[model samples]
Target: MAATAATLALDVASCLSHRWSWLLFALPLLGVASIGLFRLLKLPLGVQPGSVVEDVRNDDRVPPALAPAALVGTFFTVLGGGSAGATATSLAMASSAASGLGRAFGLAPRGAKAHRLVHRGWTAACGMAAACSALYGAPLAGTLFALELVRFDGAVARRLPILLGASFVAWLVAMPLAGGYALPAAAAPDPSWQVAALCVLVGLACAAAGTVFGWALRALRRAFVRSPAHPALVVAAGGAVVSVLVFAFGWQRFEGSGLTLVYAAFDGTSEPFDFAVKALLTTVTLGFGFKGGEVMPSLCIGALLGASFAALLGVDPSFAAAMGSVAFFAAAARCPLAAVLLAAETFGWAVAPWAALAVFPAYMGSTDVGMFGRGLTGRLSRAKRTARDKRRREKER
Candidate 1:
């Protein structure tokens, strides 16, 4: 259902873009409309994709309204040409539905709070796995993504098989409806030390890019929070900026999730600054209270940046692009293992080893808190405080 909603929204947007080109001028109005819908539904503004997953991981009860609110919000945001992806929407919807089902089934019996919490976690994980698998068309990657995103705690560990089964079944059901998201196969690079070294450089570059992207998103959200203007005004202003960008860059190049640009990078036809443009636009669209996921934009950024790196270093653009797509997402999301599996599933296992090299460097070099995880800076500070306290106690003893 989430996939269908996304597909239908994109199809409508495409039709409008081609037939009613003048609608570009009314983007601000559309943005206002999206926010208005959310406001009418009494949902909070700037609800991010990761927040829902975070709630599930923390074993917080998922609100029944979250699924519909997210779907409606994402649909309108994309319809207005916001830089967002539907994968997050799918995850949100599925997880919320799972939570609702658990409640209906009385998964939490009296005096069994611990049992209820575990049940909630695993059911949400299963839903997430199914949604991701159906959307990406990679059941293994989808399953691993759910596990990694939620962290492989005891609760998740006990229910691993169930999650995997859910993902596979979802993929099987969605295959005919949405099809797998497959990229063109690139020739595997020869295993040479020089190529391996270059992969490290690519990873570092992408990690840096990921850091910047995360900072930009946080900065924008902070700015929005601090602004004195009404949210409607802020949203309208964001839409206006997006309109200008669309007019400056071809609409087709910046539309929807920028998957077209990803394909272009794979084909070695992306512009030099495609990544920069996407990063900026995505930052603006998402930061200004738009509802959508960052996963696709992250992949888009990595693919374009990798393609550019390949062009400069005299390497295979497709191969570099494939690596960048996975490495950058790993750095930004802080999920290297899942990313490696994603690389293997999408680009064939032949690319897995090189992808690992890129992924780890990107992961290690990443400084900013990832898009989905809790703030890394905060985590580091807490750790430092804990160590300091421990040392003081030892000295006193």
Candidate 2:
């Protein structure tokens, strides 16, 4: 009997030694830290400034002036050519979190408030990394992103100080390396009642558009993942499809990520063809498993669509595009605060009013899909309310 008991104990120990067996406690920290680091360093991952933005106002500077057309043709040959640090950077950060940090550091993964804080900090790190990398000049954006996107629980709010600390650290690291596309030091555009109304409209349109984008991409991805065709064949077919589209449409809009096109849209240099080709090309790239982020491509599509609508509405295209960008993200991800912070970070304070205006409707319109299963109740409201209600009902019972 003693021998059997000993044998059982030994078996339990052996089973617990497997790496994945520890995941119930380790996974959360890994998830958090990797995301944190990804947000910290992902900004400098694209085409250089002035080179990508087509500032028609400065058309004399051949490169910036011709960036629109040249980008279409030239971007394909380059490595990591687009302004796409957000998704890649964040993914890398998440990977880091998952890789070894949690285990190496013996961090807590799941449990009560204090334990959750440690994990939350790690997860929030991704948002910080993203903010630092994407906005660089604006650390607040990174911090808010952590809160808006990563927190998801009111209790995590207690860790705000820690998140802010990481964001500040990330910002300090980012500033020197941020190069030309650093956060513009200007204020956001003034909140015109006209702009606010326009933002509402843009938000609604983006909600519908974002839902379509999410569903379409999922369909395409499902088709690719399930197809009996070889992976290489699938990729080659995708590349060929993109090539054909580029050739037929002309490269002014449908290359990688369409950052060039997005920048062009901001500069008022994009044509309708640019929008169409980019939208089609992006869907194809994601479908083929190129390993990229969708936020920018989706933003590009929304901006173009918004710009087109703005022209009809007699509103400013840049303003409308800004709102559309965030609105689409909010709808797609159900991340309203992150979407708003992102708008402010990328543009300026002026963007906040419009972003806020757009976020609500977009969030309302968003379909129930997200990159990581982020839900609409958002991080802060979901858990606490449920927990409180449960306790209350239990007490009554």
For lDDT, the strongest prediction is 1
Off by over 4 Å in 1: 108-119, 375-397
User: Model 1, 266-322: lDDT tens per residue?
Assistant: 889988888988998889988887777788888889999888888777788899888
lDDT of candidate 1 at residue 99, scale 0 to 100: 72
True-vs-predicted CA distance for residue 370, candidate 2, Å:
3.0
lDDT of 2 by residue, 1-397 (tens): 1111222222232234233323223222322332233234442211121111111111111121221222211222112121122342232333233223443555434442244445423432443333433333545665564454443345445656755765666556545554313221223556577767777887888777777766776677778667787544664566556555545544523443455555666655666545555656666655554334455566777677656656766676777666766787678656677778777777876668777888888888777565434463643367689999999999999
Q: TM-score per candidate, in order?
A: 0.91, 0.66
Evaluated with TM-score, which candidate comes out highest? 1
For every model shown, the clashing-pair count is 0, 19
> CA RMSD for every model?
2.6, 17.3
At residue 396, candidate 1 shows an lDDT of 100
